[model samples]
Each structure stands twice: as structure tokens, then as C-alpha cells.
Target: MNQLIRTVTLLWSLALTTGDDTVTCLYSQECVLPCKSDYREIIHWQKLERQTTVNVHSFYSGTDQLKYQNEAYRGRTSMFSDQVSKGNMSLILKEVRTQDRGRYKCYTAISSANKEAFVSVKVKAPIKSVDIKMTDDGITCKTSDVYPKPKISWTINGTPKIISPKDPQEDSRGLFSLTSTLPVQPVQDSLTYTCSISSEDSTQTYIASLTEEKTEIDLGQDITIPCPGSQGETGNFTLTFGSSTVLSYNSETPQPDRIQWNGIEVKVTSKGNIILHKLDSERHAGTYTCEKLTTQSRQLIQTSVQIRTASTVGIIIAVTVSIVVAITVAVIAYVIKKRRSKTSENNGQEGSGGTGHNGTPLDDRLQSEQLVEKRSGTWTD
Candidate 1:
């Protein structure tokens, strides 16, 4: 009876410990088995002398089974304890990533019966810590301490695309990792691009875009378009006026314009002055652009011309009228002075009774004398 009672007590203890179980862990962080306060009680405390066995298994296989499977955790993960007493099974992981953080199970098995404890693990990565780098070729997105692994992808104006590893590599810390390179082809206008990362339990995302700088100018004047001052440099350095190539120099100077009607050829001197002469009217208004073929620098210059007419007939008429008016005034003043002198001489001859030229009478003689006197006075005074 005592032996039967002991066997029954043992079976009851094992039964009490058998059931579906779980082990929880914070993503990318350490996960403890048996949890903090979890333990199994034996029905007869004095009956069993050996510690029970606990089996811990991850739901996924290979590297995926361990916490964190994304690129962010490529070089930083490890397990804590492989095995322990039935009441104390758990795993310790280093540099826990968000994906590594999650729920795990600990199973205590005795004979054919099993008991389980479920644990929840939470993982987090702050958005503020996320860094984004944008370049002409593509963009780089990164963050630290996200567990398991995060799914990386890109979005262009709301369209989604996956970001895969350019080449797979492993760090000294034994974390799985990858890097992705994206091709950038821009349209006529500006565009925006976004990068995002996700896991089974949480998601983190980043975004950035591209912008182009532009300039404009007008025609019919003079301009200096830059050249590829150095070698082995590449860029879009174009020179155009309206739809025509006014001047174009990239790796080398281009051929001169066959038709010089609206445009003219510009010769660059050793002093860096571009000389162009007689740019006509039709090409009067438009933009001229000069840029360094290899460098990012650029400049724009504009040109315009205004023509004036001269009036010949109006000037000739004004000069002729002035000369004629001056000559007429001089003649009139001379005639009036001569008439006044003659009248005074006649009056003086009558008053003095001077002899006339013929010597006709005494009065005539006196008149003649007076006339002589008057004439002499007029001549001297």
C-alpha cells in the first residue's frame, strides 16, 4: 500500500507539471527561461532526488530560429544558457535586435507528459537614432539595437520595393548582415524616395529625396560659357541659346556653327575672354548657358542691342534761316544812318547861306559853306 501510494504521488506530481507552455523575451534582448518566478512543484517533496529535464526549441529553423533575423542584427547575437533544470530553462543573447525580441516557450517533460511556460519579449529601436544618407547613386539607411532582424525596403512616391544585400557579410560578433545599393535615375522634375524596415512584431521607417538646381539667361548680347577646365571629370555641361547650340565645349571644343545668321562663333582667348562680334537681331532675346563639363559649377550670361536713327534735313534748314536773318539786320541799320546824315547836311546849308556847287547866290553860297561845315563835322565828329 505504501509503495502504491508513493507511485501515485509521483504520477500526480508529473501530471501537475505537464501542459502546453511558452517562453517570452524582449526582441533583440536576453530571454530568461522558467521566467523569474516560474517553478514546478512535486506532489511528494521527499520522493524525487534528481532535477527534471527541460527542452527549449525555437519555432523557426537555422539562423532564423534564433532571435533577430534581419540585416540590422547581422553581427550581434548569441544564446545565453543552452540547457538547465526543468524549472529554469532560458536563453541569454547579446546585442539584442528588435527581431530577436519576442515570445518563446520553455517545456518541462517527464516520461510522456510535458509542461510549458510562455514568455513575452519586447524589442524597440528609437526613430530619432535612425540615420539616413542620400547620394546621387542611392541612399543609405541605418539604426542600432533592433532585435531578430528587420525587413528593409524603399518607397518612391508611395510605391514599395525591397532592399536586398549587395553582398552578404558576417561581423566578428556572429550577427547575420547585408547591404543594398539602389540605382537612381531622375526625371525632368524633382522626386522623393523613402526607406523603411519592418519585422514580425514592429516596424521602423526612414525617408529622403533628390533636388536639382537650375538657372536661365537671354540672347543677342555677349556671354562666357565655362569649359572642362580639367581632365577626367564628367557632368552635363551644355551651352545653348533657345533651341540652337550657340557654343558647346565638353571634353573638347565642338565644331563651329555652319549657319551664323542668328548666332556667332565665340573664340576663347588665353586670358579666358570669349570674343564674339556682330550678333544680329533675330538672335536678340534668349538664354545662354555655360557650365564646367567635369565640375558642378555653372554660369549664365545674356545679350541685347538697340539701334538709333539720325535727322539730316531738319538741321540744314535751321542753319540757313539764322544766316539770312543776321545779314538783313546789318543792311537795314546802315541805310537808316546814311539817310539821317544827308537830311542834317541839307538843313545846315540853308541856315548858313553857303554857296552851292554852281555859286548861284549869296544864300546859295552860305548854304554851300554850311553844307561843307556840316559834312566836315559829320566826317570828323
Candidate 2:
């Protein structure tokens, strides 16, 4: 009867000492698998895998025994050495990976007491951002720094389009980048596209369009690129010329000097318009994109600018005027030459018909009389 009572008490004590918990961890971040006690001598933390056990960390004899630590968890697991005497047996795991999601067993032992705890860890990598851009080939949807891989899809004007995306490229940190394109030839000018990136637990979407605002600016004139969703509002704004960042703005503390294109300085208006003085076609004519980052959503707007030089127009007008003047001069010369030719022909005809020296027709009677008089005078002499 005494043996039975002792066995019952031991079983109750063991039951009271053992504990289980669950913790949620973010991928690529630090997490603490919690274990606590008032006494500690040896600690062992291990992951429970199917049909096997993997060593995560272990501490004994007043030092960490990590020589037998699992290769996958090396340099990623540690415990608070100073707090071990106070019975803080929590393990600090850094750079948590998706593979670390499983059951972990923390065994703590001392001279007269022993306790064990189980922590079920769940690691997640949610969708962060989805970026969509307009390209010559088409509009491309892209995202980076996501984990567990992701699926990208596109919708055109509310109709889902079937697309084959490239394989998600994995980075050195085990995150993934995904990109997909859509040909714009068959799409209408007012077409809109929405790109969605889906993970196991979250989805992020961004909407973009082929309809771009067109602005024509004269060369040497100042150009202002406006932020799309920032009318009277305030937040973070990023302006990019093509692929280069031209300006970055924050409402708390604005730094207009963050404009980094072509070693030029610019001004940001209260309404979030970035002004670039003395625009040059070679330097300033292209796509300008403004992105507004807010807590609820991200807004993007694009503008296509064309720079016209006044000198070019002036040259064209000058050439046109010069051609007109040359044509008028040629016509005047031809008319004058025609009149001179007619005058010469009339003079030649009168000369051939025996006209007087002053170009007059001679009277036959007068001429005969003059001849008789002259003849009489000669005979008398």
C-alpha cells in the first residue's frame, strides 16, 4: 500500500513539472522558445522530427555544449549564460527559417528536480510588397524578399489572363523574387492591370495601368513632377526618373536634397511637386514615377515627358522663310528677263523695217521731197 501511494505521488509531481507551449516566429528574425524554472543544472533543446531527433542546443557543467549541435542550427542558437543561474532556460534562436517550424523539447535537470517542456514553433514569411511597372515590352509585375516561394498572377481590366511566370529565383537568404510580363500590343489604351502575389498565409496586390499622363515641356523650362496621391495629404513620397531615384520625401522631416539625379538640386512644393529647373531633353525627358507609401496602401503614378526646343522650331521657321524669299526673287527675275526679251525683239523688228534712229516709222512723201530738193541743188551747182 505504501509503494502504491509513493508511486502516485511521484506521478503527480512529474505531471505538475512538465509543461507545453506554442510560439509564433517570423522568418529571418530572432525568437525565444520559452522555458522557466527556479533550479537548473543541465539543459537540452532538441527538435522533434519524424522518426529522429535533431540537436538544437545543449548546456552542461556551467558551459554550452555545442560541439554536438546540429549543423543546421549551428551559430543560430544560444542561451543567456548569466541568467542560467536564475533558472532562465529560454533559448535564443536567430535567423529563424521556415524549416524550423516544428515541435521543440527543452529538458532541464538538476540534482533533485527535473522538468521538461515542449514548444511548438511556427515560422511565417508573409507577403511584403508588390511592385508593378510599365516597360516597352509590356507592364511587368515584380516582388522580392519573400519566403516559402510565391505565386504571381495578373488580371486585365477585371478579367483574369493566363500567364506563365518565370520560376521564382531564390536569394542567398532563402527569400524569393518573382516577375511576370504582359504584352501590351493587344491591350487598349485605357486598360488596367492588377498584379497579385500570394503566399501560404498572405496576399498582396498592386494596380497599374498603361494610360500614362503625357506632359510636353519646352527645353530650358522648369518641370514639376507631382506626387499622385499626395494632394493635401502627407506621408512618404518617392519620385524616380526612369529607374533612378530623384527625390524622397517624408512629412515628419523633409529633405529636398535627397534628389540624386545628374548632380542637380530641386525643390519640393507643399503639394509634393518636385521642380527641376532648366529642363534638358537629353537629361530630363523620360518616364517619371511617383510612389506614395502609406500605412493602408501604396499609390503610384507615372508621367511621360517630351521636351521641345524652341531653337529647333525657330530653325524650321527660318528655313521656311528663306525658301519663300528665294522663290519670290526667282519669279521676279524671270518676269524682268521676259520683258527685256520682248523689248529687244521689238527694236530688232523696227530696225529691220528701216525705222529712224529714234525708232519711228519714216513718211515716204517727206522723204521724196527732201530727195528732189537735194537733187535740184546738185544740178544747179
Clashes of 2: 0
Best by TM-score: 2
lDDT of 2 at 146: 70
41: Cα error in model 1, Å: 9.3
Worst 10 residues of 1 by lDDT: 40-49
lDDT of candidate 2 over 1-381, digit per residue (tens): 999999886865562246579998889899999998765888999999999999999998999999889999989999999999998999999999978989999888766567788999987666666667778878887777777688867777778888776899988777788888987647344355666667745543434333346688777787777676566676688888877887787866755643436755577877667788777655688888878775434557677788878777798799999999999999999999999999999989876776655434466655676789888885332
Name the lDDT value of residue 99 in candidate 1: 40
lDDT of each: 0.43, 0.77
Q: lDDT by residue for model 1 over 7-88, one digit each (tens)?
A: 8877765733333234444434454433321332211111011363222233222122433243443444333232233333
Let me know the TM-score candidate 1 reaches against the reference structure: 0.32
